[model samples]
Target: MFNKKYTIVKNEEVIPGHRLMCLNAPEIASRAAPGQFLHLRCGDGQDPILRRPLSIHFADRGRVYILYRIAGRGTSRLALMARGDIVDVMGPLGRGFTLPAPGERVAVVGGGIGAAPLFFLLKKIGKIYGKKKDMVRVFLGASTLAMVPGAAQIRKMGFPLDIAADDGSGDFKGTVVDMFRKEAKNLALDRVYACGPPPMIRALAGAVGPDPAVEVSVEERMGCGVGACLSCACKVRAGEGEGFGYARVCTDGPVFDLRKLVL
Candidate 1:
């Protein structure tokens, strides 16, 4: 991981209360992988001392993008940043998703802002699998149409897209996982990757029950972005003799096997 100052290239509101910020950080961007996140200091001030963790939305060329919602003071301050501003960042941190084997059909799933990392994941998969792109599917879910971030961008990529909104505002009138369950049999997917709220991830884990092929990106409140703080601990199942154990999301994962998660 590297700690550096990056110049903001673009900062715009993609949806009400949601913003996308792109930074010119070639070193971090080039090395970043899907599911990994960046720890941003928000501003140079000491008021919000802790860095906020944001998923690496999409990385291309020499730029890295972060998708975030304005939920609190830290984020609200981040939103005020304009183009050409500089921000302190530490990243390409944490483990990322494991790519499926060639020829294995996979489904990429995301809910709300959790969909951020999956975009980079899809882009990498496309580069690696090339013509096997048809083997991949995309599923997105949000509470309402206006809440679905990056929908237009994902659609423009031309992957088979399936969307769900809890209030029936989009293509499907239900939770994303509900739609996934209904259509999973037809997709015949060999693997599934997902990220979202804890409840959603929990439901997905139950849906996939014991399936080793299901991977999830988990989120937790964090202090230090590195492992030193032990602040972002996640409960995980342990081996035979052990009951359970804690894994630091900052280092051990933000990505883990769905079946292994204790959520």
Candidate 2:
């Protein structure tokens, strides 16, 4: 991990309340992998002392992008930042998703803002697979059409995109998981990756049921963004015992096997 001040190359609103910010940070960007995230300081002063962790939306040669929604003071302040503004950040922290092997059929499922990290995963998969033969499927879900960000860009990539809006504002009128269930039999999926709210993850875990191929990126409130704080702890089923054990999301995961997670 690296701690550096990155210049905001681009900062714009992607949707109604969401913003996508690109930062110039070659070191971090180069090392970043899909499902990893960055911890941003929002401001220089101590106003918002703790850094906010955001998933790495996409990373290129010398830049990293973060997609976030303005939900609180830290994000609201971050939204005010203009192009060329600098922000303190530390990352490409946490374990990321494992890419599927060649000829392996995989499915990526994301919900709402949770879709952010999956973009990087899709890009990496595209580069590795290098075919337009429907080897990968992308599923996105949101409460409404307005809440689904990056739909056009994802669609343009030609990955057999499936979308769902709870209010029937999108192509599929149900939860993203619902869409997945409806299409599961036809896809012949070998592996599955997902990220979203707790409820959605829980439902998905149950649906998949002990399938070790299912990997999920979890969302949790973090403090230090490192192992020291123990601020982002998640429970998982114990190996020998019946109870659960704690794992730090910042270090041990943020990405975990759906069957092992206590969801």
Each model's lDDT? 0.88, 0.89
Clashes of each: 0, 0
Error of 1 at 206 (Å): 1.6
Query: Candidate 2: misplaced stretches above 4 Å?
Result: 209-212
Top candidate when judged by lDDT against the true structure: 2
User: Estimated TM-score per prediction?
Assistant: 0.96, 0.96
Candidate 2 Cα deviation (angstroms), residue 210: 4.6
What 10-residue stretch in candidate 1 is worst by lDDT?
203-212
- Candidate 1 local accuracy as lDDT? 0.88
Worst 10 residues of 2 by lDDT: 203-212
Query: For residues 1-263, could you state the per-residue lDDT of candidate 2 as single tens digits?
Result: 99999999988999989999999999999999999999999898898888999999999999999999999999999999999999999999999999888888888999999999999998888888887538888889999987887888777777888889999988899899988888887767789999999999987876654433998998888998888988799998987667899999998888998878886
Candidate 1 lDDT tens digits, 1-263: 89999999989999888999999999998899999999999898889888999999999899999999898989999999999999999998999999878788888889999898998888887877777677888889998988887777766665678889999988899989888888787766789999999988977876654433998999999988789989899999999644899999999889998877787
**What ranges in model 1 sit over 4 Å off?**
209-212
